[model samples]
Target chain A: GDSVTQTEGLVTVTEGLPVKLNCTYQTTYLTIAFFWYVQYLNEAPQVLLKSSTDNKRTEHQGFHATLHKSSSSFHLQKSSAQLSDSALYYCALMAGNTGKLIFGLGTTLQVQP
Target chain B: ETAVFQTPNYHVTQVGNEVSFNCKQTLGHDTMYWYKQDSKKLLKIMFSYNNKQLIVNETVPRRFSPQSSDKAHLNLRIKSVEPEDSAVYLCASSFYEQYFGPGTRLTVL
Candidate 1:
C-alpha cells in the first residue's frame, strides 16, 4: 500500500516571506511518482508539481519541490509567498498499475499581507 | 476554462435516499476518475474508469456504483446514502496528468 503524509494542518506566513510545506510518502513499488495539488476557494484541485526522478527539482508557478528518494520526501517550497498562494495543498502519490492516486490530508496555506 | 464538467454544483438529500452525480470530460482522455473530498479536505479516490472500463475500484461501499456510458462520461450512483456520505465529489480525466472538475457538494440530511 502507498500513502502520503502532510504534517502541517495549516501554515500561515506573511507575504514576501519564504514558505515550505512538508510532504513525505511511503510506497512498496520503486517506480512511483509524487504530485502536489493546489485547490483554491470553491475550485477543483490542480496539479502544482510532479516528480518521479530522485533529487530532481521540479518547479512551476514560482513553486519548487525536490523528490528525495532516500528520505521519501517531496517538499514544496516557495522563495516568497504571495497573497494568491492561500489555498489547500495536497501531497499525492501515484502507485500501482491502476493509476490510483493516494492523497494526504491537505494543508491549508494562508499568505497574509 | 474547465476541461471537465460536472452538473448540479450542489445536492441535498435525506438519508436512505438515492443520488447520482454526473461527470464528463472534453479532454479526450481515456481514463476518468471519481474522488471524494471530505470536510477535512482529504481527497480519496473512489473509482476509476479507463476507456469506459472499470480499472480501479477502491475500498468503497457496496452502495456506491460507477456508470460509464462512453469514454468521456462517468457517473456515480449511491443506492442508500448515509449522513457520512456528505462530501464533495470530484470528477477527473487523465492523460499523463489528471485534471479535476469543479466538484459537486453533497449534503445528506
Candidate 2:
C-alpha cells in the first residue's frame, strides 16, 4: 500500500528562525509526484510545493522542498519562519496518473513571535 | 483564487441521518477527488472521479458514495451517517496540481 508519513505532529519555532518539516513516503508506483500543502485556520489546503524529479528542489512562497527518490523523502524547509507560517502542513503523494493522493498525518507548525 | 467550490460550509446532523455535500470546479479539470480530514488532521482519500467516471475508490465504508454529473461536478453522500463521520470534507480538482475547495465541516451528533 502507498503511504506518506510526517514524523512530527507539531513543530514550534521562533519567528525568523529556520524550520524543517520531515516527510517520507513508501509507494510501489514508479511514476509519482510529491506535494506539500498548507492549511491555515479555517481555510482550504493549498499547494506549497510539488516535485517529481528526484533531488530537484521545488520552492514557493519562501518555502522549498527537494524530492529524494533514493531515500523516498521530500522534506519541506524554510530559512526564516514567519508568524503567518503557523498552520497545519500536509505531505501528499500522487502515484502515476490515477489522480489519487495519499496524504500524511499533518504536522502543525506554530511560529511564535 | 478559489476555483473549487463546495456548498454548506458547515453541517450538523444526527446519527443515522443522510447528508450530501456538493462540489464543483471551475478550473475545467477532468479529475476531482474527495478527501476526509479527521480531527487530528489526517487526510485520506475517499473517492476520485475522472471525466465523470469513477477511478479511485478507497476502502471507505459502504455508507459513503460519490456522484458525478460531469467532469466538473462531484458530490458526496453519506447514508446513515455515523458519529465517526464527523470531519472536514475537502473537494479538490486537479490536472497536475490539485486545487482544494473551502472544506465542509460535518458534525454528526
Candidate 3:
C-alpha cells in the first residue's frame, strides 16, 4: 500500500530561473530513504540526490532535496535552471531493507532559453 | 560509469509471443531489480533479487517471471506477452542508491 506521488506531470521554466518539483510519499514502513533520479532523453535514469535523514538536505549536480518526515515530502529544487536541466525526473522511495523502490509518476522538466 | 547493462536496446514482438531480457551489473551489488516504465513514464517495480534470492515479487501477471543465476545477473521473461506489456524495462542494481541500465524497450503488437 506504499506509494509515491509527483503532483506535476510537466514543469516548464525559463533558463536561469528557479524550479521546484514536488514529491510526496506514503509508506507503512518505518525505515525509509528517498531518492531523486534524473533521466535525459534516451538515457538511463541516474541518481541526483538521496537522503534518509529527515529535514537534512541532500544535493548533487546543482540540485538539492530535503527530506521532511513531518510533511512526508522530499521535493527537488534548483536555484537556477539551465537548458541542460531539461529532463525527466523521478522520485523514488526505498522502504525498509527490502531494496524495492516505489517510484512516482515522473515529472518532465522543460527549460526554455 | 554505467555499471548496469541490459541486452537488446529495443524489442518488437507479437502478442502471445515469448520474450526474454538479460541484465547484468558490474557494480558487484547483491540486490538487483526489474522495473516497468509505462508510456506515461510511470515506473513500477516488478521483481527484485538479492544475492540470487527472490526478495520482492510485485502483483504482476503470472506470465512475468524473474530468473537469477548469480548475484550479478538477473533475467526477465514473459511467457505470453500482452499488448499492455509494451513498455521499457529497466534493470537496476543497488547497495544504497540504485544504478539503472539503459533499459530494454518492448513493443508488443
Candidate 1 versus the native: TM-score? Answer: 0.97
Which residues of candidate 1, in runs, are more than 4 Å off? none
Stretches of candidate 3 above 4 Å error? none
- Which CAPRI quality tier does the interface of model 1 achieve? high
Please state the error at residue A102 of candidate 2 in Å. 0.9
The lDDT for every candidate, in the order shown, is 0.94, 0.94, 0.95
Chain B, per-candidate TM-score: 0.99, 0.99, 0.99
**lDDT tens digits, residue span B1-109, model 1:** 9999998899999999999999999999999999999998888899999999999898999999999999999999999999999999999999877999999999999
Task: State the lDDT at A1 in candidate 2.
Answer: 86
Clashes of 3: 0
lDDT for model 2: 0.94
Q: Could you estimate the TM-score for every candidate?
A: 0.97, 0.97, 0.97
Candidates 1 and 3 compared by lDDT, better number: 3
Query: What tens digits encode model 1's per-residue C-alpha lDDT throughout A70-111?
Result: 999999999999999999999989885657788999999999
